[model samples]
Target chain A: MVKLTLNVVMAERNISSQELAKAIGITPANLSILKTGKAKAIRFSTLSKICHVLECQPGDILKYVDE
Target chain B: MSKWLKIGINVLIMFLRFGIVAGYFMLIYPIIYLADAFQNHTTHAILNGSDFLRFSNNQQATLGAVKRFPSWPYALIMSVGVVLTVWATIKLLKALIKLLSNIRDQNYFSTSNELALITIIKAQVMMLLGDLLFASGNQLSQSWLLRVNTGVFSETWETCFHDVFQIIMLAAIYETYRHAMRVKAENDLTV
Candidate 1:
């Protein structure tokens, strides 16, 4: 399964969810959905914005895991 | 989905609710009257010899009062049929009103709405069956049991065709709604 490691990246970057959501111009609820791995799909623009705000590559926040 | 559309749906729901209540009362009126007439043993009650249980009266009274009185069993069956028809109609209308209310609130693409549509379909089926049973009973009693005129057969077909068409339309709407809900759920889950 494709899993999001957004919480770990946010912790390492010392960035709160509210701050990252505001920086990426997305709602906190949507950010929470992504963080909780409940999102079905993420837009390329949203991923780009998140990567830019966190100062990290997409791989840093995403991972694949077998269930 | 639009503001004006929502307002229009709201008005339609209000009108629908009123109509449902009024129609329910009108439908049950005959049942109530039959029960009262039976209770008082009034000769005013006309059964038209449609009794599934009785075949004594073969004479079809086309217009006014006949020499024979309506048996209690026939009256009971007629009352039960009327009550069932009224009950199914009320349930259908109630489900419709709930669906309309949800639409007015822009709360479409929900499980509750789907269930409501299913309920409406079920109620429609019940009503259609009840109507068919009543019509067939009348026609059969006239032709086979009482052996009177069989003119009601044509009327039965006309009514059943209309009901069948309505059921088909409702089923189509249900399928479309089900597809829309699936798409909406997928879109909602997509971040």
Candidate 2:
């Protein structure tokens, strides 16, 4: 299963949901959807925005969890 | 799914609104009859026919007895039948309208779709119960008024069976909607 670690990265970066949403040009609702792993897919552009804002590699925000 | 087909359904629903008005008007007559019967202590000859109303060999002898009996109960039953039918028609039209709007919004899979099917089931159930009451009233009165008001008992009973069949069909559609909603949820959650 693909587990999102975006919440963890956000925590490490000390970025609030509202701040992240503003930085990524997304609504807080959508940012919450991603942080909670409810998003179906993340566009590369969105991922790039998050990476640029947090200064983290894509792998730092995603992980494969074997179940 | 065609434009004309959608419009046709809408027109049918519009006619049903007219029917509801007719039903409301029809509903008043029985109450008036009941009032007249109670006030005068003798009802107007609302209906008198055993032959055309199809009295059984057993019930043929009961015609004299039916006339001697008070007519208020039959009137009350008739009113109940009309009320149930009108209620069912209203529910059915509401469901159809909701379904049309859902289709218009491309909401093929959702709880609202299932709700429409459920409304149809409820309408059918109400009609079936109304048919039962009408059948019972028919047994008591066997009047031409009943025949004119609510058609044949056996026919409406058969129609109740058809409504049951329709309920089954709607249940199948409801199940399909449930499955479609699940698939939609899965798709929305997939990465």
Candidate 3:
């Protein structure tokens, strides 16, 4: 399973979904879904955008758990 | 600016709306089925053939009395179903249109987005097919074909779609992450 640590990162950074969405140029609803790991896939550009805005690595946002 | 991201957002929104509408439908299905089943039992003597005459006489009278106000609960449920279905359908169509437009505007493309678009289209098609099956009043008890139609399509299509799309999306995401890491590494090197 693919595990996303976005919620923890966001919380640690004090970043709101709306703020992340605004910074990444995505809707807050979309950001919320991604943060919640309901998103089926993410775009590289979107990842780049988010990493740029958050100043975090991809590993900070996502992880893979082999079950 | 990336078409893939826009398409992904649209797909995510559409999926969320679909989930909500589907949840509402599942919630009301039992009520509708029970009501219809009761009406069926009363009108048809198939439930109890031996007691048919006596039950029919009483049920006929009861049904006649019930017919006067028959439209209330069923009508309300049907109306709600129609409204939710229409709302979901509209949202789905809008999302699909936006995705298509994004595809059209793409100069550099992600194969993953194309696959995601196809998956979304297939999902929508399966949804419509399920609706058609239901509208035709075909139940699982009636035919195995009806029972497995959407399931078979969804299983075969969804697995393949998810697998291929996920791989592509993951690769693109990883590539972007790597590029960012490289840039960061270079910046660190310069400093």
Extract clashing residue pairs from model 3: none
| Residues B1-191, model 3: lDDT tens digits | 67677777667766766765665555554455456555654223212333212322333334444333333333343334344444545545555555555555562244444444554554454444444333332222112111222321122334445545654664566566556655654543320
Residue-level lDDT tens digits of model 2 in B1-191: 78887787677767767766765666675566467567743223434433234334344434556457556776677567767876887788778777877776567776887888888888988988877767666655445333332443333456667877877887887788788888788766533
Candidate 1: TM-score, chain B only: 0.66
Q: Rank the candidates by DockQ, best first.
A: 1, 2, 3
Local lDDT at B11 for model 2: 78
Residue A48 local lDDT, model 1: 94
Top candidate, metric DockQ: 1
Which run of 10 residues does model 1 chain A get worst, by summed lDDT? A18-27
Residue-level lDDT tens digits of model 1 in B1-191: 78888888878888878877876776664565467555854333223323223345555444333334344444454455566677787788788888888777778678889999998888888777766755654554344334332332222546767778889999999999999987887777777
Q: Once superposed on the true structure, which residue ranges of model 2 sit more than 4 Å away at CA? A: A7-32, A39-67, B1-6, B32-52, B55-64, B68-70, B142-156
Pick the TM-score winner. Answer: 1
Clashing pairs in 1: none
Candidate 3: regions farther than 4 A off: B1-191
Candidate 3 chain B: 10-residue stretch with minimal lDDT: B140-149
Could you tell me the lDDT of residue B48 within candidate 1?
A: 34
lDDT of 3 by residue, A1-67 (tens): 9877888888889988888888889887777777666676778898888889889999988899999
Q: How high is each candidate's interface RMSD, in Å?
A: 1.0, 3.5, 14.0
**DockQ of candidate 2 (2 decimals):** 0.30
